[model samples]
Target: MFARVAQEDFSQQALYDELCAHDQRSRAGAIVTFTGRVRDYNHAGAIDGIELEYYPGMTEQALAQLIDKAVKRFSLTNAGIVHRVGRLANHEQIVWVGTCAAHRQDAFLAASFLMDMLKQSVPIWKKEWVGEQAHWVAAKGSDDDAAMRWLTEDKDS
Candidate 1:
């Protein structure tokens, strides 16, 4: 029920607890979470950190829409997404997705779907600081493919 695109880091556990405190918690049997972290290396070999940027209002709206879609599609009790912007060191958390559902299958599937959609559609840009040089990261076709899988599965379900 919460979506935030901010410059500060988030606590995965806090996100979990927020879902657990949902009014419909008694009806939820499964809570699934996905945390994306910055690694030391990408295609460029090694990196020091990444600088993320996004238009404040638009980014938050887009994320809320993604979470809303997941909630309705999966019959989720609650859901939340938090993505970090600004400079972040390697190994720091970059994104988090959490879903609460009546069953394990729904929770897992929703989490996966949200993550894929976020990567595919979100306007958040990333500039990786690789050694002394920086490069704007490009979108991967793999992310598009993964998000497409959910669209196809949505109709089937």
Candidate 2:
């Protein structure tokens, strides 16, 4: 398990390699990874960049908890999450979630679950730059809906 809230940019290949390193011999048949990027457009206007902030120790602990939940729930072999803080340009990588499991379903679902939980529960905050003005980004209803779906499904199971 690896969870990091970094101030600098991360390489996708480096993360992927680290994820696979712990699971050799094809023990974990599936590895799923997700990368989120800072988009050029948002509800406010054309986004030039974003300033991301987080509560130091609390942020890392929250992320570790999310990874632990996914690992136990999905029976994953390994998991990793890396999120970038500070100023990020449009189209720059903002977040990465990776999961490994013996089967594809577990790996895929765990990766998705990690991302949804990260969005909803992580303490990181974002301020978007729209030309000369900057606005704090708020949690979206769609994100809430997406995160809630997992809870409902878990209950049904």
Instruction: Name the top TM-score candidate.
Output: 2
lDDT (C-alpha) at residue 151 in model 2: 83
lDDT string for model 2 (8-71, tens) is 8899999999989966755898999999999999875678999999999999999999999999
Cα-lDDT of candidate 2: 0.91
lDDT of each: 0.87, 0.91
Task: Mark the regions of model 2 whose C-alpha exceeds 4 Å error after superposition.
Answer: 155-157
- Which runs of model 1 end up more than 4 angstroms from their true locations? 23-26, 155-157
Pairs with backbone N, CA or C atoms under 3 Å apart (clashes), candidate 1: none
lDDT of 1 by residue, 1-157 (tens): 9999877888888888887887363688898998999999987588999999998899999999999999898888899999999999999999998999889998998998899999887889999997777889999989889988987876235
RMSD of 2: 1.7
Give candidates' CA RMSD values in order: 1.6, 1.7
Residue 125 local lDDT, model 2: 95
